[model samples]
Target: MALTAYEQGLLAVQRREFAAAREQLESAGDDPRAVLLLGQLAGEGLGEPVDAAKKLSLYERAAELGSAEAAYNLGAAHANEQRYKVSLDWYRRGAELGQSGALRMIGVMYATGQGVEADDVEAERFLLAAAASGDHLASFDLGTLFAYQRQDPVMAAQWFLRAAKEGSAPAWRELELLVPRLRELPAGDTRARTMLGVILAFHLDERDAGAELLEVSVAEGDPEAQRSLAFLLHDNAGLPDDKARAMVLFRTAAEAGDGYGAYNLGVAASDPHEAVRWLRQAAEAGVPESYPQLADRLSELDVDEEALRWYVRGAEDGHKECMFAAACWYRDGFGGPVDLVQALRWYLSLLEVGSGDGIHEAHKIVSKMTDDQIHEAGRLAGQILAADVLVVSRRT
Candidate 1:
C-alpha cells in the first residue's frame, strides 16, 4: 500500500532523514497535521538554520488551518517572549479547541494574574478540569495553589499525592513545601504534629525542629511522636546524645504498642532474654527491621534454629544483613545441615536488591558447588530480579 505523504514524512522524521521529511510534509499540501509538523520542524530548526520569524509564520499558518497544537505552540512562544496577554488569547483558542495543556496554562495565568485578574476560584476550576482530563502537571499546580494561597496542607497533600501517583517529580517538591505549613494546623490535632515532625526529622533533616514538633505531640500522649523523637535522640548524630532519655521514650512508646519503638528498645536492652522477648513482640507486630535484629540477637544467644527462621524471613523481605547471615549459616551448617545451593542462591539474591556483597561472598564458595547447582541459583536470581524490576516499573 502507498503511504500518504504525511505518514511518509513521519517515517522520514523517525529515521532522522529531516530534509526528506520536510519535503514530504510540504508535498502533503493542506493537511493540518502536515502543516503542524512543518511548523514544529521550523521551530526546532530540524532541517535548516533557526529562524524565529519563519517559525512564527508557519505556526500562524498552521493555527489558521485549525491546528490546536499550533495554537498551543504560539501560546508558549508568546509566553516565552513575555507577551502575556497575547499568549493568554492564543492559549484560550487552544483550550477552545480542546487542549488540556492550554487549559493548564490558562489556570496558571489566572492563578498568578499574569494576563488576567487573580481569581482563586477560576484557577481552582480550570486546574481541576485540566487535572481530571489527565494533565498531571495541572495536579501539581493545584497542589501549589492549595498549599500557598489556601494554606490548606491537607488538601494540598491530596493533590500532590495524585500528581505523584501520575509520575510528576515536582509533586514531591510540593509535598516538602507543605511540611512547613502543616504547623499551622490545630495543635490539638496530634496526628498533624506527628506527621510534621517525622517529615522534618527524616525527610528534611531538621532534627531539632522536628524534635520541637514531636515534643508537642508527646505532651499530648502521642506514641508515634514518642517513637520518632526517641529515634532522633538515639541516632548519635550530635543531637544532644541523650540515650537515657531516648531509652525512656522508647520504653514508653513500646509499652503503648509501637512496633518500631519495641524494636529499638529491644536493641538497647542489656539482658539478652529481655531483648529477645521485646524483639519477638516486634516481629509479631510485623516490623520488617525486627526480623534481622531478632535473628542477630538470637544467633548471639546460640538459638540457631529459631534465628535461621527469622533470617530466612528477613532475606525474603530484601534485608541485606539477613541475606548475608542466612547465606553464611547455610554454608557453614550453623543453623542446619550444609546446603551450598541455598547459600549460593541467597548470595546471588543480594544483587537483585542493589547490593554486591552476596555475590562477593558467593565467589569463595562457588568452587565447592556443582555446576548444575550454580546454574539453578543464577536462574532463580535472574527471575527474582526481573520480577522486582517489573514491579518497580509499574509503580513509576
Candidate 2:
C-alpha cells in the first residue's frame, strides 16, 4: 500500500529528505502549509536541485491557495532568479495579504533593485507600510534608509530606537555610532540623553548602574536600546563572548535586512566562505561599502571574476578605489583580455569625478601610447566624461 501522505511527509522530514516530502506533499492535494513547505525546500535546495522555475510554480500555487508564506517565498525566489518584475508582483500580492515578510522584502527589493528598478520613493513607501504593520525588519530598514540615504538624522534616530527595542543588532550598532553625534545638538534633548544613558549602561563596559534605563527604554519600544542591549549581550565585549547570543542577534538583524549587522557578522565569521556569503547579503541590501570590501577580499583570494564583478559594481556606485582597481585590471588584463581603451575610459571617468591620484596615474599610462593612440583615447575619454558629468549633475 502507498504510504499515507502524512507519514511520507513526516518520514521525509525526519530523514532530512525534502524532495520526497515535497513530492508527497504535492500529491496530498491542497494543503497550503505543505505546499509552502515544498516550495521552500525545493527553492532552497534542502533536497533536490535548486530549481527556480519549479519553486516559483509551487510557491505561486500555494500562494493562490492563500498561503502567505508561499507568497513571500515566491517573491524571494523570483528576486533570487533575477526575475524582478515577477518578484515585485508576488511581493505586492503578499504585502496586500498582510504578510510582514513579503512587505519587508518588497521594501528591500525596491531599495536595491533586486527584481524591479531601484526607486527610493517606492522603497520608503513599502517600508513605511511594513513598519505600520508592526514588522521590526521594516522599521530597521526604514531607519537606516532615512539615516544614510535621506540624511535625515532625526528620523533615522527615531526609527533606529524603534528597531532596537525589537532586538535588532544593527539598530543598536547604529545607535552606538550615532549617539555621540546626537548629544552635540543641544541641551534639553531628553531623547538623546536618555537614549545615551541606556546605551552606556548596556554597552559601555561600565557597571550596570543605568541598566534600568535600558530596561525602561526597551519596554517603551525604543529599538536602539533593545539593539544595544542585544549587541552587548551577544558580543560579550564587556561581558563574555556568547556565540549563541551573537547568533540570535545576527539572525534577527539579518532577517530584518540590516546590511551593517549582516556585514559585521560576516566579518566576524571564521572563513572567507561565510564572509562572502554575508557580504553578498549586505551588498544586495544596498550597502555600497560592501562592494569594495567584498571585491578586495575576493581579489586577495584570487577569485578574479567575482572580484572584478564587485569592483565594477563598486565603481558604478561611485567608489573611487574600485574605479582605480578596475582601471588597473583593464590595463593589466588581470581577469580578461587587455583593453587599453577600456582602461583609459575608466581612468578618465575617475578624473572627471575629481580624483587627483587617478588623473596622475592615468596620465602616466596614456603617456606610453603612440601619438595617434593618445589622441583617440583622449577623444573617447572626453565624450564619456561629458556624459558622466551630465548624469551626475542630473541626479544631484
Best by lDDT: 1
Query: Per-residue alpha-carbon lDDT of model 1 for 1-396, expressed as tens digits?
Result: 234687667657766789999999999998887888887787788888887888888888888888889889999999999899999999998888888999999999999998888999899998988987768799889988988888778677768766876788887677687775786788787877777777678667788898998999888889989988888888775656477789889989999999988999898788998999899989989788899889888989999999999999999878888988999999999889998878877888887788888756776776675555665565555533322222234346
Error in Å for residue 200 of model 1:
3.2
Off by over 4 Å in 1: 1-172, 235-241, 359-369, 383-396
- In the range 1-396, model 2's lDDT, one tens digit per residue, is 233474456456656766677678877788776776777677777877787677778888889988887887777767777888888888888887779878888888878877678888988998998887768788889988887778765667778877887789889788777666765755454455446655566545453644445445545544444445555566455545555665555656665677766776666777887788888898887777789878777877788888888887887666888888988897898877786666766676676568755655665565455434443444455533332233234345
User: How much lDDT does each candidate structure score?
Assistant: 0.82, 0.70
Off by over 4 Å in 2: 1-12, 15-23, 44-50, 112-125, 132-134, 188-190, 205-396
Weakest 10 consecutive residues of candidate 2 by summed lDDT: 383-392
Best by TM-score: 1
Model 1 per-residue lDDT at 284: 87
